[model samples]
Target: MEFLKLPKRTTGDRSYGLTSIADFGTPVGRLISILDDYSHIIDIAKMGIGSAYITPNIQQKIDLYKEYQIKPYCGGTLFEKCYQQNKITEYLAYLKKLGIEWIEVSNGTLDIPLEERLTIIERAKEDFHVIAEVGSKDCDLDMSISEWQEEIQIFLEAGCEYVITEGRDSGTSGIYEKSGQIKSELIDELIKGIDPKKIIFEAPTAKHQMFFINQIGPNVNLGNVKLDDVLTLEAQRNGLRSETFYLEEQNANYINQAPAH
Candidate 1:
């Protein structure tokens, strides 16, 4: 296996090249089955928006993810809903009850201003490690790259462990065009002067996955990955997939290898 292993991929608890998989409500046994195989590749199990609220199996899933050493947390949308309903205190208490250790503080759907959001983030830091998200879910709220950088810097300076750009799970909004195409120009400019390691880009599709791997190298942090695609994403990261099979070193700049549009 060493013969074909492309430049080494990071292992164990990692600080970057993170893969966040969305668990849409997998039953404990099935969840365990998936985690048993992919835990090494996955860094976080996000109980995606819808499932985070009403799912009764959250505590069990959280416990299982912890057993595998993967960070488990509910999606930001749940927090958004609680914020909308004015029950943020109750929501934080609920997360603490579930043994959750990480949290996503976002205003993608709620429009909380940067200052207000930062205050909330500071408050949440008392109980959890926070990943702050920027950008709006609607296609209409376009932001210039400079504005994006400004906001990202603010979040990072505010003690957030990482700042995530809003490429919704569909990959068709926020960082992408309405048609689901990656806004390369915007992303290209955004990553300039910014450390990719301190940010997690939500890439939900193969094209999205390959783009970041090639553009930012194998260690680019990615989120919104599907459970089934974990191995393929890891494969692509290490040049194990056909599309990026030619990758042989770190920070692969094989941008020419990007899949056909």
Candidate 2:
């Protein structure tokens, strides 16, 4: 059990180095089973898209997440839907009724003016931990890197607990390329302008997870992770998996590795 030293991870109800999972209406029984084993490593559970509004036993799922210390929240797409309908007031009330303490304020699909988005974040901070998501769901949305950084900076200034870089659930779009490749140049620039701890990169694939771990170390905050990949992600984070088995060495600049023969 004490064979190797792994990278330091933020554990036991932490803020940064977070792992957020997307719950696409997982059956209650299945969720319970997953939580029984991996809840300690999961920080947030999102009812993805607009599914939270229509899913049965939604309240039970939220309560289950809370019981395991996983903060449960409806996805930003649901917030976008509510904003589109001009029902944000009712939306907040609904979230509070269901006992969700976190809410993602995003306009990935719709165009919400910056001032209005910031205003919503400021108000929502009173009732929930507001996480604002940047980037458009439609890949064609023409947003420059500076614009992305500016928007994220504005969100943090407006007081978001975390600003999510959109990679979508499909692993294509936002921070990622059409081929599901990580945009290293863009990611590097974004992090240069933004604090890595306050930013959650949405990496839905094993490749994405691996890239982030190797590029930013194990303490990088990641989101949009599938429920099934929770343990795997945690494994990579701890350097227990092949993908990141040398992560601790890399973090130490390979200071401990034997020199070339």
Candidate 3:
């Protein structure tokens, strides 16, 4: 029976979930080629900030991403530009026309009123998968943990599918320090009040990823992940890669499960 049983694995994995990846900078066909090979593992692809501005052919890449069953969306900064310029309606329509499946609603660069942000969340829910970001791009604009808790509740109620803490692709600044580390006290306080599944830490560095895996387990939601690292992240989450370091007590429990005596 012990031989038949597999090691206890983490949850939220349908064969070790790999939801994020690094940039695909080449021809759209090249991206499709990679996705075709790895579709079983890759779940989401972000084109990253303003990268789309380079070529008119970028829509072809998004189309390929959709065909591969991967949700691709514009970066939060691009959307912020749209939202700040009062082009929300056009931006939403453009995304729909382009057949985009996900959108990141963020107030990272400019100030968006809470009421307006809630409205955007609700509106995005109607047609697209919404991943709402909950931190400022500027480190100086930091809000108290209490404010974050309240903001998260409002965003959840308004229908943001996943609330991503702002790591801004570098995993430095925002909730993390300049050294690219999360403030454990703040994270603990946030977790104490919010559902872990609904919130995503934007962990862009290996250190940050390892830290979050140890602190919150592999079931934690992560965002702004690099495209090439998808498989690696999944391996860490599944306990196949030991660098993330699962809690020893958890390993002890698994070890102690009664073998037929």
Q: What is the C-alpha lDDT of each candidate?
A: 0.84, 0.87, 0.71
State each candidate's clash count. 0, 0, 5
Residues 103-220, candidate 3: write the lDDT tens digits: 8888888888888888888888999988888888887677888988888888877877777788778776677876776877888888887877678787887778867776766555
lDDT of 2 by residue, 9-93 (tens): 7778777778999999899998899999999889999899999999989988999999999999999999999999999999999
Candidate 2 clash pair list: none
Clashing pairs in 3: 21-226, 21-227, 22-226, 22-227, 22-228
Comparison by lDDT, 1 against 3, better one: 1
Off by over 4 Å in 3: 1-18, 22-26, 245-261
Top lDDT model: 2
Please estimate how well model 2 matches the true structure, expressed as its whole-model Cα lDDT: 0.87
Worst 10 residues of 1 by lDDT: 252-261
> What lDDT tens digits, residue by residue, belong to model 1 across residues 1-261?
456657356668878778989888888888888888888899988898858778887777788899999999888888898889988899889889888978899988989878878888999999899999988898888988888899999888989999989988899788999999999988888787677878999999999999888777777789999999999999898888877776664434432222311
For TM-score, the strongest prediction is 2
